[model samples]
Target: MRRLFILLLLVLSCSSKDTLPDITVKDIEGREVKLSDYKGKKTVIYVWSRTCAGHTEDLKKLSRLVNEYPDYRIISYAVAMDIKDVQQSYQQIGIKPNFITLIDPSVKFNDYFPITFLPSTYLFDSKGKLIASYAGLPEHL
Candidate 1:
């Protein structure tokens, strides 16, 4: 029985990291944005907070990657839950203006992203299927 239980736990954990909910989020401009809209393109969805000092480097690296790959779509979601804090972090970190910013107020991401940590990144293929998910800056960026 114990072995069976362990196997189930392992299976659940391994499989849960792949896909994410196609939840709707509000952009900084108050426009509704859906993850599904980015379908048919390589997309990177970054979830980070304003106060996470460790995320600064990852953000910078991601910004550079986005610039280098014009065909890829990168979206940033601020889990800070406050637009003011998000804006302040943006200015402090020097996030480029072209980056699309989304807000996840009410912390609904906990249901889909398993954000026990501060920063998480999800990568999707051209079909909008999740290719991989990482807790921090992945080595390949």
Candidate 2:
């Protein structure tokens, strides 16, 4: 019975990561953006928190990648986990990022895309399928 339960749990975990969740989140500009909207094009999403150490550096690196790849849809998802003041956090970092930064106060997609580490990035193909997932700053496009 225990063996069967373990196998079920494993399958459930694998099933959840098989695809990206379709959800709408608001960008810093207050524009409603759907995760599926980036379909038919390659998209890279960076889920980050202001409280993470060395996050400013990671944002700088990601910002550069964004500029380097103008054709690819790059997003910077700012999660509100353990965050007290969002504006103050950015101000303290002093790194003004130039990318499409989205805010998820409730972290609605945390279950689909668990943030195991700071500055986690998820890459999706043109078909909106998850191709890769990284735990730190992505150095390449």
Once fitted onto the true fold, the runs of candidate 1 whose alpha carbons sit more than 4 angstroms away are: 1-20
* Alpha-carbon TM-score of each model against the true structure: 0.75, 0.75
Clashes of each: 0, 0
Whole-model lDDT values for every prediction? 0.75, 0.74
Query: In model 1, what is the error at residue 141, expressed in angstroms?
Result: 3.9
Report how far off residue 68 is in candidate 1 (Å). 2.4
Cα-lDDT of candidate 1: 0.75
**Residue 50 of model 2, lDDT score:** 67
- Residue 141 lDDT in candidate 2: 52
As a TM-score, model 2 comes out at 0.75
- For model 2 the local lDDT of residue 98 reads 76
